[model samples]
Structures are given as C-alpha cells and as structure tokens.
Target: MPHEGEATPRISKVQDRGWAWVVLVATVLVQALTLGFPSCVGVFFKDLQYDFRASNSETSWFPSIMTAVLHAGGCESILVERFGCRVTVMLGGLLSGVGMVASAFSKSISQLYITAGFITGLGSCFSFQAGVTVLGYYFIRRRALANALASTGVSIGLTLWPLISQYLLDEMGWRNTFLIFGGVMLNCCVCGAVMRPVPDKPPGPTLKSCPEQSREGACLSNGSTSCHEEPLHPSKRAACFQTLQKYLAFDIFCKNKGYQIYTIGVSWMVIGFVLPLIYLVPYATLNGVEEHKAALLISIIGFINIFMRPMAGLLSGLSIFTGRRIYLFSMAAMLSGLSNLICAISSEYSVLVFYCIVYSVSMSVIGALIFQVLMDVVEMDRFSSALGLFTILESITILIGPPLAGLLVDLLGHYRYVFYASSFFMISAALFMGLSFCTMEAKNKLKETNKPPPETPSKGKYTEVPTELDHDRNGPPTVVYVTSI
Candidate 1:
C-alpha cells in the first residue's frame, strides 16, 4: 500500500487492560478446577480410610502424593512453551478427567495412588503452569492485581468444593462421588478453550556475513552484494527439545542470589504450609467437633481468604507497599506460624474459629504475593524456569509434610505436636526470608553510596552561543561568549 521507500508503521499494543481481563478470567477458572479439588482432599479422608482399612498415616499419602506431584510436575511448563497453552491445558483436562474416572474404579490404595495421585496431579501441573504463565504475557502494570484476582479462584474452590464434596460423600458414597467429579472435571476443557494464546511478533530476518560469497560476487553491475538471511523455521522435534531446555534451565539458581534465598526460604516454609489444611478437619473431629462442623471451619477460612487475597493484591500494588512486599510476606508467614502455635494450645471451638480467621489472613497475604515477589527477583524470560525449579524444590516438602504430620499424630496420639512442628517450621522460614530481605537492602544501599558522582565541565573553555541571544542585545553591539572553564 505504500511506496518502496516508505517504512511500514507497526502498531503498538497496550497491556494490562482490555482483553487481558478475559485471559485473567480463564486463568482463574483453570486454577479453580486444578487447585480446588486438591484442597478438598481432606473432606474425603475418613471415607478413604474406612474403605481401604488403612491407618491415618497410610491414608494421608493420597493427598500428600497428589500435592507433591502437582508441584514437582511443574516441568510441564516445557509443554506449555512447546505445544502452546491451549493444547497443553486441553491435554491436561483430558488426563484429569480420565484419572478421576479411573480413580472411581480403583479397588485398593495402590490403584488410587496411580490414578488419582500421579495422573491427576500430572494433569493439574500442566494446566496450572500454562494458566500462570499466560498471565505474565498479558499483563505488566497491573500484574499483581491480576494475579491476586486470578488466585482467588483457589479460595472460591476451597470454600465451595468442600461443601459440594461433603454433600456428595453424604448422599452417594466415595466411588460415585469420584465418578461425578470426573464429569465435573471435563469442564476444564471448556476453560482451556477460552485460553487463546497471545499473539507474538514475527521474527525479523537475521543477516550473516559470507566472506566467500562477497569475494565471488564483488563485481556486480549495481555494485551491491547480497547477504544470506537465515531461515527462522526449525524442525518440530528440534523446536520441542529447545522448548524443554528453555523451561528446564538450572543456571538461574547459580546466577540469582535473591532468587536462591527465596527458593530456600519458601522450601522451608512449605514443609508446614499445607499440613494445617490437610489435618485441620481431622484435628477438629478429635476434639469433639462434628464432622460437618469441621468441614465448615475450612469453608470459613476459604470465605475470609477470598477477600483477603484481593485486598493484599491491591495493597501490594500501591506505592507505599512498593519495594517492601518481601517484608509484608515475611510478616504474614510469621503471623501464620503464631496462629498455629495458638492452635496448639487451644481446644475450644471459639478459639479454633478465631485461629482459622487469622490463618486465612496470613494465607491470603502469602499466596497472593508469593509469585509476584519471585517475578520481581528474576528476569522475565527466566520466570518459567525459576518457577519450575522452585516448584520442584518445594515439592520435596509438600511430599513429606502431611505424612510427617500424620506420623506425629500416630506417635503422640494428639494433633497438638503436629501444630507445634508446623509453627516452628513456618517461623524459621519467615526469619530466613527476613534476613535475605535485609541483606539485599543493605547491598543496594552500599551500591548507591559507592556510585561515582557526575563530572562537571572544566572552567575557561569557550562554547558556541546562540545567534538569537546576540539579536536580543540592544546596547553597544555587545558581543557575548559562553565559557565552561
């Protein structure tokens, strides 16, 4: 449409507004489906134990394995980069649906471990990574707010799924409940359909000099020579391998000190982070609370968590909270630890209810900002790799956390020591994170103080003066000169 000499105009796209919200909605739904069901595993604990005739620690492995695989399986981020978000998520939905259906037919604990724990967890990993990664592509300025809003889906699912799972377990037994849940999980395909990939700019031509070609064609009539333009396309198999390598890169651990500190601190924190969620219902039942009432306690935490996540997100995005989110996160972790310690000492329903409310506040604040803080520390291109490695490390804790708590319950004959252990781990993690934050700040201040000041121009060096200034002079045809030194 334009002359040969005219440069083409490229349209600039605005981010963090408009269609980005749609992507956020789809991400929320994906998270709700993936994380919500796992959070409700506690509701099925008694049913599973009764059916399998297993001990408490043995039964706890179902959720523990599922949680561990879900986190460690973040390696699925490679599939997101290679196959694209929609395909990877759709595949995940299919696997999840099939796994749930298979779990319904599971005759023993081992079968459940294979079907429910490994398959469903693997599928959830794919869907979760794709959903989380897509948000970074669509938002920049409002990234924290978007992540907060999207993460609330976890709270919503946590709140509602327990009630739904409880009703189903009450009416139709565990097997039929899993069958119906399989059908419910098929809806993840629909959510995947909504996850349209954000378009990327096409790669520009790459020029490479060819000395041999230049020498052979130096005498062209136009006196201009052609250079080779490398093709952008690669074989699909090679591309897939490259994608895997990109997401699995481990150099980030060695290159980023802040990220290293965050990873270690979070790994320690996660050892206790999920134990309370998995054991709370059982603990409540041990202390004279009814089963239904115990389930309601989780719902209460979820209800409060829903509001707290968005509030934390908005607060973290404000200027006052800028550059200080890590401190907020540390405080939240400390409060969570303190709440668990209080729970260890209390048996009254009213006291436990208050503890749940406080736990919700801390959980909301921590969950909402955890990834955002990681993004702040790592380069954007390396985020997926960083998240994958972090998840893999955290999975070690997730895998062991619940089972260890269950072991304590078995030996001590009470859940109080479990709570005490959780409180200790969380508090230690918080202190580590706080130390890392202080160290980073001190380094930044030192850098600022050591930076060299700008050099001033030397005096008595003549510089050109503007002609308009000479015309402005009215008396004695005054000649003016500017001097620097």
Candidate 2:
C-alpha cells in the first residue's frame, strides 16, 4: 500500500490493436486530407501560372510556401500538448477549409499566397503534427507498420486527387475548384473527431495546502491525479513566453547528437528530394508527352507507392533490419538519386514510366523508414520536440528548393538540368548520411572492443578438468587442465 500522501505509478497503456488501429485509420485520413492535396498541386501549376501571369519560379512559391509551412508547422506540437490532438486537428481542418474557400476569391497571386500558402499550410501543419504525435501514443512494437499503413493515405490522395483536380479545373475553373476543395478539406474535422485521445499516464498524488490541516497532515484525495492539473495562475507575460518555448522545442538541437546528425542529413536531402515530383509533369510535357499522360505518371508513382510503403515498413520492422534501418534509408536515397538521373536522360514515355516505377520504390522505402529511424534514435517522450526541430530545419530547404529548380529550368530552357541537380543533391545527402552511419558503427565497435571483460566468479583461480572420458580395464581416466589468467 502507498503511504498517506504517496501515489501509485501509472503504467502507460500501450494497446497494439483495438482503439489503436482506429487511431491509425484516423491518422491516415488526416494525412490524406492534409498532405495529399499539396502533392497534387502539380496539376494546378499551369492554371495558376496562366491565371496570374506568373513565371515558373514565381508560381513555384505557392507550393514552396505550402511545403515550408507544412514542415515548419511541426511546431504545432505545443498546441497538441496544450489542446489535445482532437482539438488541434479540428482547428487545422477549419483553417484549411477556410483558406481554400478564401483562396477561391483571390484576384492576385499575393492573395493566393496568404490564403492557400500560409493559411492552408498552417492548418496542414496542425493536423499533421497532431496525427503523427497521437500515432506514437498508441503503439510501440508495431509503430513501424502503423506508420506505414497511415502513410498510404498520401499515396492514395496523390493517386486520386490529380485526376479529380484536373477534371475540376477543366469543368469548374480554378476558383470553383478551390471552393470545392475547401469543402473536401472540412472532412478532416471528421478525422479529428475520430482521433479519440489516448490516455496519458496519470499524475502522482499532489498535495495542496489546506488551511485547517498542517502541511505534514495534508492528505491526497486519490491514488492518482490528473496529469492536466493547471498551476496557480502566473503573470501573463511569463506564461506566454513559457508557452512559446514549449511549442518551439528549440533546445533539442543542443542536446541530442544523433538527432542533430539526422536532422542535418534530412535538411540537406530536402533541398532536392521533392524537386522531381514538383517538375515531373512539366518535364514530361516539355518532352512532348500529352498533359493527361504526364499527369498519369504521378498516378503511377502513387499506385506503386501504395504497395511499396507498407512493404518497406513491414520489412524494416523485421529482425533482419534491426539496428540498421538508417542503412536501408541510405540505400533508398541512393536509389532515388539514380532514378532522378534516369529521369534526366529519358524523354521517351515508356522510359519515363520506368523512372516513375523506380522513383516510387525509392520514395516508398524512404518514407516508411524515415520516421521509424527518428523514433528509434529519440526517446518517445521527446519525439514531438525532435520532430518539431527537424521540420523547422527542413523547411528552409523546402521553401527554396522548388524555386531554385524552377530557376534552373528557366536558365537552361530544359528540365533535364533540374533533374540532374536533384540527383546530385540527393546523392550527396546519401553519402553524408552513409558517412555518419559508418562513423557511428566505428564508434560502437570501439566501445565494444574497449569494454572491460566480465569478472570471474573465483578471482585469480585456475581450474582443471578432464578433456575426455577413458573407459578401460586397467587405466584410470586421464585429465587435462585449462587455466585462466
């Protein structure tokens, strides 16, 4: 029994199935609604450009800002902690819907930037962070598989949204399409609703001062208390600053070496990671493929990815990839780089199809393992902070990568150079991560070799034993002695 004021330690309830799988489904929907729409922005590229009379580089800012905000939005973890995943995601849904609805009324590119880029992007960040963070709350052993399964929402959205968006653009025009997309985005509220909050560990018994009872005699009301207990109100300014610090998670970079290495590698990789995706349709059309056919290529990538992501997740979770998921991620990055090189050289439709297949495989493998690797390196309690820092760092590349790729396209009067640049950056990122992995392995090996040997049960003693048993009529068994120093 606990003492008068003592509390029982609450074990976290980690359910691998039941409500956990439901959370996975909700997370998948949230991801589809939040991430899927941005990926299909490629289908809107031409319309956006023509309507606003913007150059490729200028128009690229829409997706760039959106992507940047999506990543930078990881800071929504503070909201998740304060408001809970359900409310945060609901707020995100409302903002995204409102942004899209407002975007339909925009007469200029700048308005689109505010409505589509900043508002929708901010909403996406909230839903994404909440969905991902809540996912980690539900499963431990099966987290990789769950993440993979949830990630398929992106592929599904990518596969379907392009077709839908293209059709909508043809019939309704960009303005009406934005209006409808806003409605579709509102479904995220449903997703948020389904995200039943996973119960956190209950707080220990806390003593509150009682005027009648002495401090020593103060009694705990219950064996457990609410973890959500509010502190006595503090100064408003101090509270505001504390909230900002909690949300920003700025200290993670200073404290975690492995996380820092991973973040840097991811940041570098993002500089080119999605460049091909952004430019694929344009590149294909430049090569004389029909617009519809080029759009189909994205669907192809999505279709292949749907299967590939789950497979990668399941395989990585197996014992074979234990302690070496980062190596798998590195290999995937290298393969993606090679795929980009293939895309750079290939103009034929069939060859581009092959490139899509290869790219899909690489993308799926990397996506499935990336978060798993991060989670493996960071403690569960710190995942939100680490992820927030990672997103903010990666957002720098996301914001600039597309515009720079577009600039290359404009300068060269071709798309091949952009692909080449992407390939180079991706390969560079792979090499950097590979080098980091090798260094980590070497350090681990050195530690192993330098580890002190186990103490012997009998210190400084030598023991003798028979090497073999000899059964003979006239001879006793012979013995052999072994000594340890």
Tell me each candidate's RMSD, in Å, in order: 13.7, 13.3
User: Using TM-score as the measure, which candidate wins?
Assistant: 2
lDDT of each: 0.72, 0.72
Give the per-residue lDDT digits (tens) of candidate 2, residues 1-485: 24322322221332466777887888888877887777778878878888999888888888888878977854465576556778888889999999999999999888898999999999988887677666655555565456667788888877887778777878988899999999998888888887765443222245242232223322211111123335588898988777655545556566655666777898988888888778888788877998788888888988888898778877877777776777888889999998999988878999999999999999888887776677666554555556556667788888999999878877888889988998988899988987886786676556557986455311111111111222211111111110000
TM-score of each model, in listed order: 0.80, 0.81
Where model 1 places Cα greater than 4 Å from the true spot, the runs are 1-22, 136-145, 207-245, 443-485
Query: Residues 1-485, candidate 1, lDDT per residue (tens digit)?
Result: 23111211111142456667887888788778888778778888878988998777888888888888877754564465456667777788888888889999999988998898888888877777666666655565555456667787788888888788878888998899999888887777787777665543222223243333324322111111233333369898987676555655467677667778888999999889898888888788888988788888888888898898878877877777666777888999999999998888987789889999999999988887787677666665566567667777888888888888888888888988888999999999999998877876676566557986336311111111121223221111111110000
Going through the candidates in the order shown, the clash numbers are 4, 0
Q: How does residue 221 of candidate 2 score in lDDT?
A: 19
lDDT of 2: 0.72
